[model samples]
Target: MSLTRLLPILGWARRYDRDDLRPDLAAGLTIGAMLVPQGMAYALLAGLPPEVGLYASIVPVLVYALFGTSRQLAVGPVAIVSLLTASALSPLFEQGSAGYISAAALLALMVGAVHLVLGFGRLGFVVNFLSHSVLVGFTAAAAIIIGFSQVKHLFGITTERKDHFYETVEEVVRQIDGTNGTTLVLGVASIALLVLMKKFVPRVPGALVLVIASILAVELFDLTDRGVKTVGEIPSSLPAFGLPDFDTGTMGSLIGTAFVITLVGFMESIAVAKVYARRHRYDVDANQELIGLGASNVASGLFGGYPVTGGFSRTAVNDTAGARTPLASIVTAILILLTVLFLTPLFSSLPNAALGAIIIVAVINLIDIGEMRHIAHVKRSDLIGLSVAFVATLVLGIELGILVAVVASMLVVFARMSKPHSAVLGQIPGTTSYRNVERFPEASVTDGVRVVRIDAALSFVNAQHVKKLLLGEADAISGGDVTALVVDCSGINDIDATGVEALSEILVELDERQVDIHLCDVKGPVRDVLRRSGLWDRLDGRIHATAAMAVDAVTHPGTLPESLRSLGIDERHDERPADTVDTEVSHA
Candidate 1:
């Protein structure tokens, strides 16, 4: 591997010109404008000091820019990761305590270590275990939970945080009488302003506007005396490098949360990276992304920060503003650094209500109702998976929600493969293509040939199922009149030992029924496996390039079964004319 492959900055810096700087500067500034309010809001979401969010944004963005492949991906404190941090640490330590901070830092370090190892081992494909449906369900539910979790802050009421979403909602309602009128007004007004701005002037940073307005209102109207809570006492200094607590007991408790964070964060980052990479006609290396994210988290841990990941909104903002290289992220980091050094005090009077409103607005978008509708229309089976994940996350808790969703996804995959789709294929008139007989009723099958298409890879889990399905189809056709059974292996991309055994048994049974088994459109790898397993010799060179060719050859009278041959049926002459056959098939 070249140095540039490991450190992407070396590759981009070699081609960096004055022309690239203009867009990078514009993207960087735009991302920075959005980052300030979001960073603070997400930090509070994680139950940490507001400065921790800014601290996380700095090194993570700089580190990922140096190592990540996606030029437009902006690494920072995202709402999901922050909510996960809060969920994991809330039970172990009180929010805003030194112990909670240490635990959060340790979790980041552990997650970073896992990402680094997976990246180095090139195990980025492990994320395939997390199905897209599960992700959608989990994200939608988590977004709702995060939004409701902020109700206390929005209402300026004190309530003990609960694990389940309903418990939180109940607590908020129970404390409704304690709601501060001024804080509620500020939060509601901020959310309304953000919604309007997003609809009317999308180019403007509405969160920044809300923050500025809230701070000015609090300072000018003495809103603090009227029960409107301000952020209060933000430290104006850069994050000092520090080591996380290395206590084994704490480490043991955090390992599970850390693993969850590693998987979820890497999945979120790489997904957004691949989207923009594909749109721009470039490929994203998943392993390299794992490394970049790992390095970022490691830096975050060493600098008294919690876990962080690439935020989709900020990345979209970076891309929309014309980011040409990782230089945009570097610029974002520099601006955030400037904020930590000199502008922290300006946020001192920033209202917590405004921060809550910003989080609610930003996270609500993650609940994709349109995606749910699409899934429902396309596949009802997926609706079960989505509902399980969404309800599990909302009712059980974040960690258990992910666990249940993963298990459910795996089970769904296994079930689908075990009962894989095998279709009785028939040729369309004057076309080489074959389709399912049940779907295209006008398509005709050869008189003495049965073409069965097993539309899944032949694996151990579905080996017997495929055999049974083919046998059932053959039985459904005339019992002993079909002399040639062509198994269309076009969809069978691979075969295992169990699949080979299943095929061998299928051949023996077909021979007993006085039928010759032919394999058509066999994939190269599957053929290689069959050859090695001695099934190729059993096939006796009956394989053909396509299903239609196999059927064409077997349609001859000489190839017909003894019973069909004795019936004196002319195989070459269709007893039914082409038009008549089409009409009969279509009506049937």
Candidate 2:
């Protein structure tokens, strides 16, 4: 593909037409309705005011719609991100305080930088480290954290500590005797009402209903007399744009936390983009997505808001609501802006407990217990990676959790291919192609030639392992039992700089050992890369027309060997998505 042709923005938007506007309008209205409650709930989850939530959904959504590649990805504050914001900022300042909000804005700036860098570099693949199992585990753990942290509000008890799950439970138990009956009653009622509405009202934005009911219940009962806290009077105005107070000391204090926020935000945003791309049957540009997401956060930071991204639930809602262009997101932003201008004070009586309840219910859905089971059954190592990430994230912190998952993923990949499968090959009795000799007992081998397959991409991570495997194979064939060698190159799909350098070293060793090396079945792309690698011209052997032809030539130089001259081999190879299918030569 040409570099100029690879621009995703041009590919999709250039073809967009007036026909796409209705779908965009429908999606905008649906997402706008959903965003109002969800945004406020997420803001509360992030330890911000409900109004700030409304602010985050507005301009950021508009920014992402303009710059993003996804047609339906909805940019806004989300549950997980808000929880992450709270975790990152709670220690630095009092929740809901001015300093905390400023920190949140600074965090958004950092997240924006991360996204911009990754997107430009096309490094979206970084999210692959957080596998499905790890994600499930982390989400489950976060749900528990969100639930437990809100217990104080549930009991109408004021406390100033952050032990996350266990400490919250301990604090609740210690204060159990002091729990206000009125507050507990309110909390319980809110939870139940929200659950019932969500279960039955499906498309009615259950959160909006629950919030209204909670407010009405609190006001009707004059719950403040019994010590229940409300959201208080929110400023009914659009967000004001400003920069975070950036003292060097402040930056020093918060840079580490900001990096964690950046990483988590990137992971989340890219994941949403990937999901939409797959669903819509269009390729998303990772680099451009980075820009879109970065721009959103940058915009959020400027507007007294925290870091934002392509929210999973909102994006799904946008897609299901029939968003056909990025315009839907922009319109959703307009809706939020209007809410900020008119409806902020309606939330003055919304109980913190209700917001917490919404967060807890939402986060609980993220944890996937069945996925852990599947990983444990199919791949214990991967399950371990997920488990380690979960424990680290819970016990250590958010930053450590993400770093551990990345390290674990890389380690798993390296360990598996370290001693990559190198095998002796021969022709099966009733087949014409080569197969691993160990797997096929009835196989034939050319008198002095052995074929081996290396099954993994070549890179610095496994280059040394390949070197060891090649040396061992050379020694194994050293009884002068093998003189000619053909490598089945079907499994080797990619090669890197380190791999080419390693191949050069390996070739030198093979030449010294007097084992002439040849390659066959190198796919077109892989072959082109290798040709550029300069390994082909320097090798002491040939690229075969076919593995079968190479085998026959090894057995018979002038005339076909008696064993092969009569029995013809299928030299024409067909490609399939399944793992390699090879016919072994008869050793019998």
Q: Which candidate has the highest lDDT of all?
A: 1
> TM-score of model 2 relative to the true fold?
0.82
- The list of candidate 1 runs beyond 4 A from truth reads 430-433, 479-482, 552-588
How far off is model 2, as Cα RMSD? 7.1
Instruction: For candidate 1, give the lDDT of residue 578.
Output: 40
Residue pairs with clashing backbones, model 1: none
lDDT string for model 2 (1-588, tens) is: 343333344555678788889988888987887777777778877888878888888888877876777887888887667877887778778888988888888888878887777767778776566676667666666666666777777777776666455566677788778777788877777778767866786656666677778888878988777677788888877789899977576667767766666566666677787888898888777777778888889899999888887777777778877888888887788877777778777778888777766766666666777877888999787876787778876776565666776677677777887767677788877667788888986777766677778888877778888878776766666333448777777788888888888878878888898877777767666666676877755641355545776766555543312232123221223332233322543321
lDDT of 1 by residue, 157-252 (tens): 999989889899898989999999988988899999999999999889898888888889998999999988888999988988999889898888
lDDT of 1 at 344: 90
Clash totals, every prediction: 0, 15
lDDT, candidates in the order shown: 0.86, 0.73
